[model samples]
Target: MKLNSDYWEDRYQNNEIGWNVGKITTPIKNYIDQLKDKTIRILIPGAGNGYEFEYLIHKGFKNVFVVDFASTPLENIKIRIPNLDKNQLILSDFFELEGKYDLIIEQTFFCAIKPNLRENYVHKMNSLLNPKGKLAGLLFQFPLSENGPPFGGSIQEYKKLFEADFKIKYLEIAYNSIKSRKDNELFFIFLLK
Candidate 1:
């Protein structure tokens, strides 16, 4: 139940990452495609396998970065994108990480952590973003229960959780989620308040 570095590393070694989609999900990819700036600093916390990281780089995004405590996925990224800057692939706890970014891309990291850490995750995300920066991506939408690393949440819950620190620009069921996640995901964009 301790979702620490070793736990994640073991998941990778065992190929137990059920949350990984093996490729960037459509909602996130569409979001990135609409972005006109390629130089903005971006961070992808809990970047398991880094499909999004690779997608951004391949699309000419220069300041993209990824942070994951597990060395396995970070190493996987290095092997997949041989020319990627090593410093941009940080192998460290997301909470302990420092530096301001214009954007932080969230996928499944929020659910992977214990539910008790949800508030801390929001604060940490707010701290890592520069003024007016955004935290954008998909969040799973389902009844919150005791069974998951792929924990589920509702739109109303998310609104209360982020509205204090972020201007919730968008939060609704994702219209273009991958088939597997169709009605189960919510695409959101929250700008720093």
Candidate 2:
């Protein structure tokens, strides 16, 4: 099954995005709250409803951007944030995207892609970040299986996958995950190595 624009659009059209928690999850919100630089360029790839994007704008962040191939959520975002710059909403494949951001906010994008693309995703993220940039957000901590866009992975797997490209700042159970996610989520911060 191709997890392309059509697949994702169908998901949104059918309300099948279980990973979308309506708003930015608590772990990421707490991380964003502590960030001292509001000017940092931030990218949230595969940002379904862009709750993080919405929250950042509310918090006075000006250089935030979100990319998604599906048009449904992007249109939804436009309606929700009428004042948002249209250019900041990129409609393109994340791998083909080009830019340098000081921080890339990962929510569910990592798992949404095919498992075979995991290494490529890491490399693309590496190329997208500016020097010493960071990638921070939540990752599901569960068994890997063939069943989902919300496919899961363990901390050990994540450490091996990201360690060569990033210095693991933290990779552990998320203490503040929403009640639904609870102990099933991992909050992480990784700085480009």
Candidate 3:
């Protein structure tokens, strides 16, 4: 119930990361494919296994970073990308991380946090980005409940939570999500306000 670093480290040690899709999901891949800038600083917080980090680096993106409280996934990424800068593979609490990024990619990170901290998550994300920077990616679209690290959320809730700090560019059911997540994922692009 703590959901602390120990909890996450145990999950990795036990190989219980269901939120890890093993590869970058389609919605995110498509979004990345469209991005023309390869020099923008990007951060992926709570990046278990860091599939997106791998993809970004493979696509020639520089200045990409990933942070996870658990060391296992960060080590995995290091092994997977042996040449990746050590500094870019941040093994620390996401909330404690400091930097300005052109973009922050959200995957299952939001859902993994306790719901009560949702407001703080928004503020932290807002503070992390530079002016006009973006926070984009998929959010699971299901009812909130007590039974998960994969906790669900809806567009209305998201809008109310993020609108104060971001310009909602797009928020809708992701048409290209992997089969398991089809219709259950909302892809969004929120630019800093």
User: Which pairs clash inside model 3?
Assistant: none
**Model 1 lDDT on a 0 to 1 scale:** 0.93
Evaluate residue 173 in candidate 2 and report its C-alpha lDDT on the 0 to 100 scale. Answer: 97
Lowest lDDT block of 10, candidate 2: 17-26
Clashing pairs in 2: none
Error of 1 at 24 (Å): 0.8
Per-residue lDDT over 1-193 for candidate 3, one digit per residue giving the tens place of the 0 to 100 score? 8899999999999999877778999889999999999999999999999999999999999999999999999999988999877999998888898999999999999999988999999999999999999999999999999788888989999999999999999999999999989999999999999
lDDT of predicted model 3:
0.93
Model 2 TM-score? Answer: 0.98
Candidate 2 residue lDDT tens string, 18-107: 777788888999999999999999999999899999999999999999999899999999999998889999999999999999999999
* Segments in model 2 whose C-alpha atoms lie over 4 Å from true places: none
Residue 193 shift from truth in candidate 1, angstroms: 0.3
So what's the TM-score on candidate 3?
Answer: 0.98
lDDT of 1 by residue, 1-193 (tens): 8889999999999999888878999999999999999999999999989999999999999999999989999998899999877898999999999999999999899888888889999999999999989999989999988788877899999999999999999999999999989999999999999
